[model samples]
Target: MKVRDSFSLNPVGNTSKYTDFINYIDTSSVNAGLLSEVSFLEDEFPSRAQRLVRPGDILYSSVRPNLRHYYLYNDSYEHAVASTGFVLLRNNSSYNTRFAFYYLSTNEVVKYLSNIAELSQSTFPSFSSKDIGKIDLPDIDRKAQDQIVSILSAYDNLIEVNNKRIKVLEQMAENLYKEWFVRFRFPGHEKADFENGIPKGWAYRRADEVIDFNPTLKTGNQTEFTIIPMEALSTNSMVLDSGCFVRQDSISGRRSQNGDTLLAKITPCLENGKTGFVMGMPENEVLGGSTEFVVMRSKALTPHYVYCIARSYYFRQTAILSMNGADGRQRVDEDKLKSTKILQPEKTVLDHFETIVTPIFDGVYQMVQENKNLIQQRDLLLPRLMSGKLEV
Candidate 1:
């Protein structure tokens, strides 16, 4: 049925209203994107004008519906204030947030909201309380709500934990970069000079000086192509697909090579950490990706160092600062990439660094790939689990 029909069906009878009514704007403030932890609303909106989050408020993101980001609020965030974008539905202080949260949470609801989400045609998607609360849901009391929420939240928390682990590994790579390159206090630092903080023996060099930059061979015309596209990327790794393929745009204009660094030049994607080394390109006719990827030559710069630098805070900052464009279609310059400065270590030193960090990035990328598998498994299980086709 059409999503509009879901609201009118009045599938839920608890008779909840738009969030604005009970959403007490707290004098307290929370920064919207600040929270990186597992708890919902860890990073909520920043408002000196505070709003209260009672233990039972259901949290939803008005923007970026793609995240499908919805959560049941709990006493853990009792005094927290959410951004205006989120609405807090307090179930008459009697209904459990978890119970209502489960019934309210549905793939159907997300699909319905996404169809009508608000966004500048060029930007991310958004929704409103009228759009939200009006969606269909199963009505139930706090106790049963507790059981459903308990199960879901437990799984959600596990996902959050894995996310945190990924973050820690990311941090470790950064710290290692700083220690060996910035501090210049490596195993051989003592024999090296202390020129300008870098080890005295270490020489400053440009990437162009260290590595040969090979632009990939461009695929021609409007010919059809299949690809294990670089949809998910990191400095060290990327996720490839076999079944999914699309027409090659200028961004998708090039043939991927064994050691290419697939840097997403487009905004949001560039910022979303889509830049990564392309070691996963399948050797076959079912292949070709965007011109957004420029092959990085590791002739002098080892692929490992190339991956590390691309993913470091330094390169990310540079890339972010260099972005330009209007509307939601902002992008970084492919030309500007060559102009970025790079630090080059001695060949042997780079090799050693590669030896140590190669496995680290490999493991991290493997984990990400593993998490991708877990996501598929969990999603496959969702219908069965929720519909009782499969018992937890």
Candidate 2:
């Protein structure tokens, strides 16, 4: 059956004039199977904020359909307005909304939409709301659909819980770094002496003194290395996406090994805090990623310590200030980054700090790996269930 037979497209339209502070959703705010963030629209762009969205509606990106940016709206986003870039799918009496959402999120539907989009004559590939409505969907029984949704949602729910735990763990590490290093409130602060606002033995040194910036790139076509693109690095997550493997010769980006930190050096991405520590890549396997990254390895500090320092608000602010180039194409100045000052604590104190935060970061890495596995499992089961190859 056609999707239109089971769902209505954007059932509500924003026609009221008195409504203020419209909740808005854009393509970038939506991740695959997740709604990461939303923007609230005021009176500034009245015309662009006319597509009213309601609870249970699926907002699927019509433009750049291959990215598969879609989300199921809930009470949190009730009465929101989304950009026209989305094809809102509102479930009807014939199908369950959760089932419709999961079906749309399937790889099969994404591939279908992507093929339809590529066939378009427009310079930027896209499909219309009518086009979306025409796509055929399985007319599964509602009970079976409910069973499928329940099974899949269980994995997603666990992943979400792990993500929250990871966030708190990361924050705890960052906060500890701030308290000890930034605020000079280390364990022995009462007995420690200070000279000119510096700890008695601690010294201000250039970042290069402790961190190696963009070390030598390994070259060869013989080995298969994991390639991490800019999109694979989520802002502030400090975890690299499970990247694809390619022959070394095909890669033209910065090279890194496990334990190195990656920072997006380009505009917007840098501003968005695209920084992560390289973890869980096969042991001893060389990793290559976007050339726009400044790969930093710690020589004197612990890897976790370096990651926290790089992701610190002060460091990011300084890096942003040092960026130079034309608008939208600006990049961080490597020289400026190397010259940035770093606070070096006594070896014992550094050891204590590392001891305290290492397990926290280790837990974060473990959670990231678990989430990746969960996503893989869910994706693998998706097609089988959707096609009835596996009974729910």
Cα lDDT tens digits for candidate 1, 102-130? 54445655566677775436366676666
Q: Rate the local accuracy (lDDT) of all candidates.
A: 0.54, 0.81
Q: Measure candidate 1: CA RMSD.
A: 8.1
In candidate 2, what are the lDDT values of residues 192-280, reduced to their tens digit? 99998978999988999999998885555435666877877767577665532344545567888888999989998898778888877
Candidate 1 segments exceeding 4 Å error: 1-57, 62-94, 99-105, 117-127, 140-143, 193-201, 211-214, 217-299, 311-337, 388-392
Predicted structure 2, TM vs. truth: 0.88
lDDT of 1: 0.54
Who wins the TM-score comparison? 2
Q: How badly does each model clash, as a count of residue pairs?
A: 20, 0
TM-score each candidate: 0.64, 0.88
